[model samples]
Target: MIWQPLLLSLKLGVIVTAVMLVITLPLAALFTRVRRRWLALVESFATLPMVLPPTVVGFYLLIAFAPTSPWGAWLERTIGLRLAFSFPGIVLASCIASLPFMLQSLKSGMQGLDSRLWEASYSLGKGRVETLLRVILPNMRPALFSGMILTFAHTLGEFGVVLMVGGSIPGQTKTISVALFERVEALDFAVAHRYALVMVVISYTAVLALNLLQRVQLERRS
Candidate 1:
């Protein structure tokens, strides 16, 4: 029983983390290279989820994902897929909600790299893509790990956006957070405790690992 939601949360985390990585890599790289007023506006929009209330974000996402909405309707009609109250819906929601954490980490990593490295790569006749894959990414292991783990951790605890979009469907969208809420609502403190404890342990471990990684990076730099 408890294992179900736990496993679901893990699945959700993995999928969302993977998807976010694919989505953010180029965006982060772009943000790292570009300097313009419009880019700041785009960055702000990307980072908005961190500041906005979860419910507020969820509410708007819900509207957008609703079948009645043009975006949702076109998706369903064209792709034969539905977003509202579905696993894919929550995945989308989680990706949007966790975008900034991964993007900022990778962007910071890119920005921190020696600009001379890029110049050297260009002098060596390497394209931007080759440089990113070979030179930039290899040097940013800490940031890569931080982005992946933080995004995974954040997805595990996601409730409002996921709940609003995916609802509490068992064996599908019913993540540990949603399970915890249900257990509490049912006056089942024991099960709720288990769920909550699992989340705390996982989230704390992720954060601790990130801190330790940063410390190690600092030590190596010093």
Candidate 2:
């Protein structure tokens, strides 16, 4: 059985989760601090992906990455990197598709932080970055783990967005989900079953870990 697709999926999930954590941590913190009337609009924009169809997101990403589009053209001309139909393209698409999972989880954690803790840190002359790293992050361990796991698992199982952006380039963009679809299309049910079973196990493991983590968190709180 071909293993490249599964490996690619794992690589994509790790990269996506790492990047998402870096980007989402600051964004979630910012979201929790904003008190303006337009905060709802900003939040809705961030959470839009959770409800939007994966195909719809993929369609827009495809257009944005097309060689003729200005963004795509600039990247190609400046960096000599074309995102469309490439591994990077799949990563970008998965990032967008799985963003809300991380954002919401992190945001909820950030919001739960006591305002007095921020005040105390500031009183001690700690910078926002220092406070976030030293205090906020330690307290946010559960949420961080949840977000990372969810993003990783979600990206691993992504079908529509990855397919639309990356196509089925072997050892490049053919992730496990896309590979499974191709196998089924080629009437290779036996191989498809193997892929499906693997995915099932992955999904079950993620769910079990999340539940255990939640139980631990609840016990600590109580």
Candidate 3:
């Protein structure tokens, strides 16, 4: 029983972390390429979901996903997908909640890059997109890997947003954190203990493994 939400959380975490990496890479690329003046605004927007209370983002997303709005209506009409109280909805929530981890990691990595490297790439006839994929991402691998682990762990603990939008739909959106909360509220410490311990071990081991990998990468590069 406890394993159900635990596994679901893992699945959601993997999906969200993967999507966040894909989305943040080019979005971070835009920040590096575009006007410096717009960087702060872009970053603020990207990280907004991090600072805002989860319920606020959830509330707004809820509104946006409602039947009336064009964006929500189009999503439903075009894809036959509904964003409320679904696994997909939880994934989107995880994406939003974890956005800052991805952006910040990518941004910090970008800042460390030598300007001359990009110039050299252009001089060597590499295009922008090609350079990004081949050169930039290679350099950013360590940061990107670390960011993904952080985002996955953070998404596992997500509650308020999941609560507001996902509504504890078992086998669909009831993540381990939500399940833990349910057990705790019901004074079922025995069950909650099992869930919490699993999460603790998973989070600790996953992060430890990533950090070790990062250290190894840095050592090899050095």
Candidate 4:
């Protein structure tokens, strides 16, 4: 059906965004607090995915997830989960590809916080966890929103990495971008136009909302 790939893309985006949020939030918080040289290296590594070619990341991931590799072998033998060309596999790939978008946005947000807020919370006998939940996170709403939107948008448009890792398994790994590519190759211009138009609208709306959010945050700060 025409809606299958679009729906699958939405599903992939949501899952990838949720996973990145869980994985990147703590990392971003920690990065904002740390200043060691080694931490800089770690941060650089975390952002490398954004700079690397998608196919390069996909190639390495493909090898790592191959059944002959130790990690893949152990995963299969222990839990009977095979990642290569599978839904979970593409999920992991999308997570990696989208990590920097979420991480950088959140880290910037965390860094933009005034030091006095958390210090004030500490002086008031609030613990780190309490301050993070009540004070820190509440202040970073713009960053959170921006990160989620960016991650979801990026995942929806993922093609090279998704194709290299998951291939074109319909109803499983065939996302909107992948489906669009297939349509074009098959010369199905009408269907391809539909997919392209949807992506454009979604991407523009997300960016516009992010811009408005930033403007509002700036206005409130001033």
Minimum summed lDDT over a 10-residue window in model 3 is located at: 60-69
Candidate ordering by TM-score (highest first): 2, 1, 4, 3
lDDT of 4 by residue, 1-222 (tens): 778988988999999999999899889978888677789898999999999999999999999988899999999999999889999999999999999999999999989989899789999999987888799988899999999999999999999889998999999999899999999999999999999999999999999999999899889979
lDDT for model 1: 0.93
Candidate 1 vs candidate 3: the lDDT winner is: 1
Q: Global lDDT of each model?
A: 0.93, 0.92, 0.86, 0.92
All predictions: root-mean-square deviation over Cα?
1.0, 1.0, 1.9, 1.2
How many angstroms is residue 126 displaced in model 2 relative to the true structure, after the best TM-score fit? 0.4
Question: Candidate 1 on 16-94: residue-level lDDT in tens?
Answer: 9999988898899899888787999999999999999888899999999999999999999999789989889999999
Model 4 TM-score, all chains together:
0.96
Give each model's clash number. 0, 0, 0, 0
> What does the lDDT read for residue 74 in candidate 4?
99
Give the per-residue Cα lDDT of candidate 3 at 34: 78
lDDT of 3 at 128: 92
Error of 4 at 151 (Å): 0.5
In model 3, the runs with Cα more than 4 Å from the true position are: 68-70, 213-222
The TM-score that candidate 2 achieves is 0.97
Q: Which lDDT tens digits does candidate 3 get at residues 1-222?
A: 768898899899999999998899988888877778867886888889878998898888877776677887899899998888889888997798889988888877887788777888999999998998998889877777878878888888888888777879889999999999999999999999999998889889878978797789779879
TM-score for all predictions?
0.97, 0.97, 0.91, 0.96
